[model samples]
Every structure is written in C-alpha cells, then in structure tokens.
Target: MEKMLSVWKTAPKAGLEVKEAPVPKIKDNEVLIKVKATSICGTDLHIYEYDPWAQKRIAKNIPYIFGHEVAGEVVEVGKGTGGISIGDHVSAETHIPCGYCYQCRTGNEHICQNVKILGVDTNGTFAQYVALPYKNAWINDKKIPHWIATAQEPLGNAVHTVFSGEVAGKTITIFGMGPIGACAVALCKAAGADKVIAIDRDEFRLGFAKEFGADVIINGATPGTDTRKEIMDATNGLGADVFLEFAGAPAAFNDGLATLRAGGRASILGVFPKPFEVDVTDGMVFKGITLTGINGRKMYDTWYKARSFLSTGKVKLEKLVTHRFKLFEIEKGMQILQKKEGMKIVLEP
Candidate 1:
C-alpha cells in the first residue's frame, strides 16, 4: 500500500486535515514520481479557506491533495514512456492539455479548452507518489537544487508575465511581493529593466524584495500615499512603463492601473477574490495601456524560457528561499504562508 496525504475536505475555515491515501496507479503514457519537494502557493491558501471558486472546481471528497509546485525523482515509468527512467529528476507543468483542442492546435495549449490542472482537477503531488503524463514532465540540470526545482511553476509565471511585454530598459512596478512577485522582480531586473519597484504591505516581504534586485520597495499600507508617490517619482513623475500585478486584491489592480504610464503595458497575474469593477475608461483610453492576462505557463515553451533564465546565473534563487518544511508539517508551512512573512517556503516529502 502506497501511503500519501490528501485533503479530504475543504478547510472550511483555515486548518485542514491530511488523510493518508494509497499510491496511484500509472497508465502507459505516464510516469510515477516520488515527490522530493513541493511548495505551498497562494491558490493552496485559498483552497484552505474554502473559497467559492475552489468549491465549484474541486470535487467534494473526503481527501483531495492540492499541490502544483512540485519536483521529484522518477520512481517508475509505464510502458511506452520515452527517455525518462527511474531516478531522473523532474518537475511537471501541472497543466495537462489535450493536444486535439483548437487552442492546442493553434499553439496556445496553456489555455486549451480541454485542460486539467493536476492539483486542482485530479490527484496532485502532495503525496509520496503521483502519476502524470510524460509530456508534461520537464527535465532540468541534475545539479539544480530540489528547492529551486519546486519553484519552476511559480517562476514560469514570472517569465510568462515579464517577457510577454516589452520589459527591457523600461521602469516596471510589481504590485505584490509574494513568491511570484519576488520572482518577477528578479526576472525584470535580469531582463535589463531600467528600474524595478516592489510594492507590498508586509515589511518582511518588502525587505526580501530587495534581495531579488528591487531598486525600490514600497509599503502598500497607505495606498494613495507614499507607495504610489515613490513609484511615480522613480519613474520621472510619469509612472511605471510596465506594471505587473501579482497581488490578487482588487485594490492592487486599481492602483496598478492608476500608476501605469501612458502607453504602458500592464500584466495581470493575480486571481481576485471575485468579480470586481475596474474603471477601465479612467486611464485605459488616455494611457493607451496594453493590459495582459496570465494563466499557467505555456508547457514546454515557457519551461524552456524559465530554464534559460535560471541557467544564466543573472537570476538568483539562493537568497529568495527563506523557509523549509517537511511534507507532514505542511500545516505549519501553510500557517507561515498565511502570515505572509517569509520569502519562499519549501516543503520536503
């Protein structure tokens, strides 16, 4: 019997129990991974809190493991699997897209109409063993640290967001200092952004932002005051040329829109609590701002970009990792993330 941890019920509040489960069976085109490391994400926090979105998407079951940021060593490969073998280090794209879909054929598989996110739609990696399609697995430099390997999912988000727009030599303001926000700061700076400004309410996260090459760190407590003022002042009173909103709060989106420079590009990577109104007419017309939205990474395409960014050595992941926990102690990790104090938190299974 393969033992695993599963979220049987929504936290309904904050704390949820992990139920032990048997290891999953693998199909011919899939591989079984013994998870070495997994990271808690913002979505996991929302799942813990039993949000309406998760309620609709996640099946109501006794136990449902919800971890997408994962890395592991291949333990078994079913018949017909290619190249990958036992002991190979790997991380998955989480999103398993059906190649037959229109979006998939058009090269937009990331948003394929028929897509299944491992952690959300099916059994995820918060266990000793998980079965995944061979196509979604990505092999990295064997020397890559397990901690850094688990971060590929979030880092890919940073790549997809910052690189999608014109970021080179432009002043950019990042609206959140969460894990992905911090990653964006590093990506922006490494991509030759003229300046990088990080905004967040947490002083610790803001301080951590500095290590990620943030030229300026602003506290978002006084929304309409110093933070916004500093961002504007840093951009020659014009406002940031690009604003990447990683904070899911509506306030952050509003502030991002207001603080964007005329003809600037804005990328929205955050998931808001619910549908909130944004006065698009306020600055969208006058500013001529290009607003971009992000979903998951574009599988192999984005993964290749992210890996290149890491291989460059210009983007640092060492200092960003501040906390680590074991798989059974996932509860504690969740608590730390909920408190929003640490920079990057990793969990070992």
Candidate 2:
C-alpha cells in the first residue's frame, strides 16, 4: 500500500480531518495490517473534542493520526516477526510497553512507566493500513465478526476490572454505562454476581445496562434522583460488594467509594479530565476498601480472557455495537457518540 485514507487531528483545536496519509512502514520487529474494521474509543472522543486533557497530552502532536481499536488482516510481516504471517486475521493490544522497565520486568507491563499507547502516543489503526509491533498483534479467531473483533481490546478492560476481585455471588455496581460499563454488567452477570446496579447520566447507555442484566438502573441526571442512595438501597443497605467506576465524574468517584462496603474492592478505569478532591480517609482508608487504578489490559492475561469470552459467544458484542460507518464517515460517528446515542461505533476502511 502506498497512500492510505485516515482520520487525522491536524490541529490543536477541536474536530478531526479525513485525508490521505502515507501507509505506515513496518520495522524489523513489526507487521503491517490492512485495517478491516475499527472503532472509536472515549479517548478518541477527548482528542476530537480537544478537551483540557487532550490539550495537555496530545496537542503538541498535531497533524497526528489517532484511533486504537481495530480488527484487521495481516498484509506484510517483517523478517524478525515470528508467530504471525500474511493473511492472518488479527486485533491489536493497544498498550505498547518497553520490556525492560521495572513494571514490565515484574510481569506488570500493562503499567510500564515508559509505555506508549497506539493512538495517543503514535500512529493508530483508524487508517487503511497500520504498522504495529508484532508482539502486540493479537491473532483473532477467524469466526469472530470483524466489528466484534474491534471491541476485544476494550472488552479486555472490562474483564480485567471485573476479575480483579472476587465477583462470584457479590453485588457489583458500575458507575458508568459506556461500552466498557455495559460489558461489565454482562460480565458480572455471567460470572454469577448476585446483583448488578448500573448508574449513568445518559438514558441511552443506561438502556444497554438494563439489557445486560443490571438489577437496578439509575439515571443520576434524572431530576433530583439520589444515585448514591439508590445504589445503597439496591444492595440491601450494606452497599455494593464491588464498585467499578468508569464515569470519570467527581461525584461518581466520591459516591461510589462512599457506598462501597467496608473491606470491599473498587476498580477504577476511567480517565478524568482533571484531578478532583475526594475524602480519602473516610472514602478509602477508614473503610478499608481496596482500590486499583487500571491503565490498560494486564499485559496478555486480559487478552486471553477477553478472547475466550468473545470467540466462544460467552459475551455478545454485536448488540453493544450500536452504529457503523465508513472511515470517511467518521464525522457522523463522532456526532452520534458525542450525543450519547451510539454505544460503540465501528468504522470500516
């Protein structure tokens, strides 16, 4: 491939541009994949909106291509890349880690200090072709739908968060109804959770939570609805045994922790635009709750679990994918996503 179609953030301002870019060249340890399907992520939305977080993190990298989630076919493989070949169907692990880092050496490469993200830190998969480190190219099951394959990376986030603590028979509350939060609802149900409570400001996303088996769905934005009290009441006043926070809202953070039972676990995977204050002593220390800040999939562990759930039909993704468009129609996808009408929007090149 010589020239490629891609969505680009060409300026430090809001919005993106779809234009032609040179097909990425693969290094000795990399592979080139023809993108068959790709999807937008919340991170992509931030970059497109050029929020404060985007301004501080990626504005300097203007004229860059950004999008991480994808499913594609291997078109070229470098000499040093083994266990992967041309024609292999694949999805990518978006976290590119430096193997020699302290965290990487300790089997926690998911949090490597020098990690580089696919879309945020480098050129990404929202193009006709992309070059990726062979180690990060996850060979997909040929039977998995291309659109569904694009979600495996994000699904891994849900799986990691759900399983980070004991989930069986526990009451779990997820404070966001985004794609990942929806997946967490399904995961908790499939893993034998006794009750699932989902909270979100958007009614559209809350609908997915209901379909995925949340025992109670609360619209925190609904006129004067007390979300914290609703969650506590749903959990029989003991509060949730586990709280998974993905809303990235300050109120959600404080309320989620305050409602969690003492000695319970909380897994937070959201990226807040800015740091906010919280009552740490009463919220976490005095309560003796466990909190884990998830960054990316846990190296390859989450990958294996995510693949098993997706390929075997254990967790359905087709329903969660509410919109689709050509890569050229990225503007439409972005609009729908911003309106909260689309759950996970897939783009084809």
- Candidate 1 local lDDT, 1-349, one digit each (tens): 7677654444444456677888888999999988888887777776776667766666454256677788899989998889888889999898899999999999899999989888877778777778999888888778888888888788899899888888889999898888789889989988899999898888888876888889988887854656667777888899999999899888888888888988999989898878998888877987788988989887668899899988787677756777888787887877777787666678887
lDDT of each: 0.82, 0.91
TM-score, every prediction? 0.93, 0.97
lDDT of 2 by residue, 1-349 (tens): 4899999999999999999989998899999999999999999999999988899899767788999999999999998899999999999999999999899999999998999999899999889999999999999999987888998876899999998999999998899889999999988988899999999998888999999888889998899999888888998899999999988888898889989999999999987767899999988999999999887788798989888877777689888899889999999999998887899999999
Instruction: Evaluate residue 285 in candidate 2 and report its C-alpha lDDT on the 0 to 100 scale.
Output: 92
Name the lDDT value of residue 226 in candidate 2. Answer: 93
Candidate 1 — what's its lDDT? 0.82
Cα RMSDs, all models: 2.0, 1.2
